[model samples]
Target chain A: MSLIGLISFIGTIIIFLLSKKVYKKMNWIILSPLLICPLIIIAILLITHTSYSDYNSGATWLSKLLGPATVAFAVPIYKNFPLLKKHAKAIGLSLVTGSAVAIISSFLFAMWIGLSNDMVNSLVPRSITTPIAMDISEIIGGEPTMTAVFVIVTGLTGSIIGPLVIKYIRIRTSAAKGLLLGMGAHGCGTSKAFEIGELEGTYSSLAMIVAALISIVLSDTFFPVLQHYLVG
Target chain B: MYMKIIKIILQIIFLYGILLLGDGIARLVHLPIPGSIIGLVLLFTALQLHIVKLEWVDLGAGLLTGELLLFFVPSAVGVVQYDQILGVIGVKLVAVIVLSTIVVMACTGLVADSVQKRGAKKA
Candidate 1:
């Protein structure tokens, strides 16, 4: 990477760190680093006429670190294992059915709209966290970049409308409400759950991780059958 | 301070080693899931069996998780490449996402709520 690219990468991280502070301080979802950092980086790239390739040169280093970071998720999953075991049946059943509903509906809708195969696969995993969604998208021949956009949009939308929907549904427990948010909105929703209560945050975090695992398993099995059905 | 730095670096190497082992096994076995995920499972196992202590790698993993979102920023910023492609399917993508999200959220909440409530009654 060139000197400018290195500077750009460091500068982007610094700016994103600042935006995250603002996000936490203001408590506005709009200021989410997930939303703002990308916008800021893209804007800088555009204004400076730094091509995507040049920017990617330095950015790829950060991306490479994503692998270890994803692996690190095991720590939290392990920490929560006891809670996970306690509610195993409910969480398991909820994840399977929720992911099924998401996959089948989104696939049918995508097919109905005549979306290409890649878009269908990508859209199918939009509800998962960004890293896992991106991985799933790539494995299924979808665009990771598009997957991120889809994830962000889906998560942001769910976070925005989730409370109203939950209120109308009258879910009696914070755990239940958190499950809804986590499965539907992922990282974005889990953060929102943190605002609601401790139990909500715990369930949301658990749901988020469990839902990702369930989605991966589902896609592994469902993708082959769906592929044959959709394109055959 | 010096020992702390070394410990952090060693833990990072441990995590990275697991990732590579996962990649190797995935290739040999033709696993559909990604290598890092497999590494995650292996690491968890190691911790459970006392093959690897949590303290050894927890700090290293914390370093990764702390700025985990930052790692994704570069790739997410790759959205610029999809400007034209998005213009084509943007509306449909948005619609599908919106509809599915609502349905998933409602159902998951209802299911978890009712299931737990029933379990409580039974116990």
Candidate 2:
């Protein structure tokens, strides 16, 4: 087998093993690849001198699978239709508001910090999942790859701190917790929400779908105008 | 059991078709959103509009959701290559993630809670 293929196999096995162990331990932060994998890889690269291109040569195979994986998300959304229907209005309102805030706040903050337009556009989609965020970043003339990094970091942060914030604020409803986390943070937040309970997971799943939809709309509509203004 | 398998396979095909259609629309219009995401939105819209029955895709969608984490593996691995970027931007990245998440959660929570309470009051 090729070196890339060999690495892919090993990477899969390691991820599988770690995922199982982390799931069993119920350690949302550690169990999540969004948090653990990046930290581990960063540590490896920092200690060693491996180039990203070399790693990506192997990792791209896995990356290609992202599309199919995303297509598969339809399954979950289908399964939870009843729950979604029950909270449709609430979900809709929350998704629109949450998505707007996520992109707008990031943009405003990036601007305040005097980061370049590219950086602002990259950060605008930080709250969305990587693939979608990358597309948005590219459309807006930001570096898709950099946007991917911000997406991962955003996801990990959401997964880690999401639940704690819920508890701290005394938000007790599983539905509320899940919706907030998923809408604001995407997959990582959904994973953490799942750790709390099935109700939380269900709501998180619904939120994830809704958030994706809202972000898509925003990327197509609001972002283009923002991009034009920033670039011009 | 055979029927279930066939249904799952068919649903996958339909989902793929939706993704492609969305992608085509995006390309034609020069839209920023990818086809898959457009497909997701379309699917959700269809569901809301009752154009497609939820039962048609339930099983497959369930399986996908269960393993959504697996899909992120490849990109997560790329983090291995970004060590230097992580070092220089690590603090900023961390700040962004931490602050953004908190702000999102707090804001969403406030909105949802107040909305629910308002609905309750009207009820």
Candidate 3:
């Protein structure tokens, strides 16, 4: 039992490494590791008749590293602070407006479509990164697991349509492109930003983090009450 | 080679230490934010304050954060556990996520672009 778990855990790393090469060869978003790696792992487990619980005993190690990796995100943010500092005023204003719009629109849209209040609440934190979004979802009385799903779908949405949006919209600046992707898509969007350029990646990282902080304050302190009044 | 290895190890330790400190403060203050984010903020402050140098963490941060998506797999697989819940509202949820993401991206891009253009004009 333990052996299967360990093998499955290590198998994830090897598969991911292999997927990277596949990604390089295919060069398609549909074939990207984020979508593919998980599918492969799930397939392997299903074939072997290994329970998700058994497979996860080892997989949890990789998951645990996520927190520290998030902490490490500060390094790049720190390195890029100087460039971001110059646009502090712009970043500040845009982030506030963007975050507010994300929360309000998602909440209203979910409600308008006749979903439950809890579903709307889950959608509220969908625009931000997973770790922070999951935390916010709990505070706002949304389902964390559902919130994660929303976050991934959001990222996938951005990854698919992000470039088209940029090209047609004529955003014209790397900064705006970064912010658009980061604020809308979160981590995967940040990945797209890097693909565009260094400056875009930096700006997207800033956008992601700023939007995250704004959501934390609003969701934890105010969103629960807001949800009650709006939905009730 | 040995010195380089030590440097990398020390860098990871420093980052982990920073993360722990952030976690402690967050627990103490009862902040709504995650410890990792607080750690990011603290690390940012440390960088600005010159409490730590950028080079110490450059490699480690790049290596880890570059592959950040892998860490998200476990939580994502939780979707498998939610088959029944998903069946109820999966279609609507997907619609909302797709449409809302497009709108949000456009709105954010428009706001940032207009503000940045104005900033440039002023400068």
Candidate 4:
């Protein structure tokens, strides 16, 4: 392997090792690998002035694994089928309402602040996963790359702070909590849901999948109408 | 152990095939969403219909799901490449993210609570 590849490998190993110790001291709730990794990269970039391309070249192999990882979510959904069936109506309703509100609220907020159309488009799919968010960004004339960043930021913040929000509000059911986190926050929230319990994780994963689908369809149909009536 | 590895490899190939097929259909029909999302929806539908057994796909999917955050590293790394653009739009980006997150969380929480209460009433 090349030097950069070796460095990336070693870096990941180090993070994995540190994670164990960190996990012991902090609740998995507070210290997420998701939140830590980017900060590590940023710190490295700032200190070493290492080019992003060099780091990405080393990291791309791991990144490509995302496709298979996303596919892997199917396992939990399958395992949780019984619970899902029991709560089918509640899950379905939450997904629809949560997704609609997420899209509309984000769009309105973007408009309220008078962001450019491209910037607004980037903001449109902020709650969805990267792949879906990128597609929505392109269709709406936003920069896909920026949308990806916004998606990660949105996910990370949601995942990290989501539980606190839930606790403060005193929302109790596993299904309700998971669906809200998953729909509003995507992968990040799903991870947090997983940390809470298997049941929460399962619902959160299902919610993430459903929310992404709902957001894509809503954006396609509603964005144009929004543009005509609100933007124009 | 060897059998498990082989199974995972097969599952990956199967999922990729589904993604490609979905992409092709989307391209042909000019669908707004990407082929992969369509593939995911198709897969979910197939699972619900019992057309495809979940047993074979479960292990691979489970492994992948736990490590989902790692998948975003590439794109996140890509952000570092656009330091100038980010610097220019940084405030707007932060505003959009922070504001949207609060809105999404609040709205989802309200909707979920109402749905749960409705479900409880029926039960």
Instruction: Give the distance in Å from residue A130's predicted Cα in candidate 1 to where it truly belongs.
Output: 6.2
The lDDT values for all models are: 0.79, 0.70, 0.81, 0.75
Candidate 1 structure quality by residue, lDDT tens digits, A52-165? 888888878877876776577677667777876788788877877888888888888889888888778878889987777888888777888778878877876787767877
Error of 1 at A109 (Å): 3.1
Model 1, C-alpha of A183: deviation from truth (Å) = 3.2
Residue runs of model 2 more than 4 Å from their true location after superposition: A1-3, A26-31, A38-55, A216-232, B1-25, B28-32, B41-60
For candidate 3, lDDT tens digit of each residue in B17-37? 888888899899998777888
Ordered from best to worst DockQ, the candidate numbers read: 3, 1, 4, 2
Per-prediction DockQ comes to 0.57, 0.40, 0.68, 0.49
- The CA root-mean-square deviation of candidate 1, after full C-alpha superposition on the true structure, stands at 3.4
Top of the candidates by lDDT: 3
What overall lDDT, based on C-alpha atoms, would model 3 receive against the true structure? 0.81
Order the candidates by lDDT, highest first.
3, 1, 4, 2
Pick the TM-score winner.
Answer: 3
Residues A66-181, candidate 4, lDDT per residue (tens digit)? Answer: 65556556667776788798888787777887777776777888778777888888888888877888988888788888888788778877887788778877787888788878
For every candidate, give the share of true A-B contacts it also has.
0.71, 0.46, 0.70, 0.50
Which is the better candidate, 1 or 2, if ranked by DockQ?
Answer: 1
3 against 4, candidate with superior TM-score? 3
Docking class of 2: acceptable
lDDT of 4 by residue, B1-123 (tens): 999998977887787777787778889999876666677667777887889798767766766676666666556556665664467466666676776776676667666777778878887
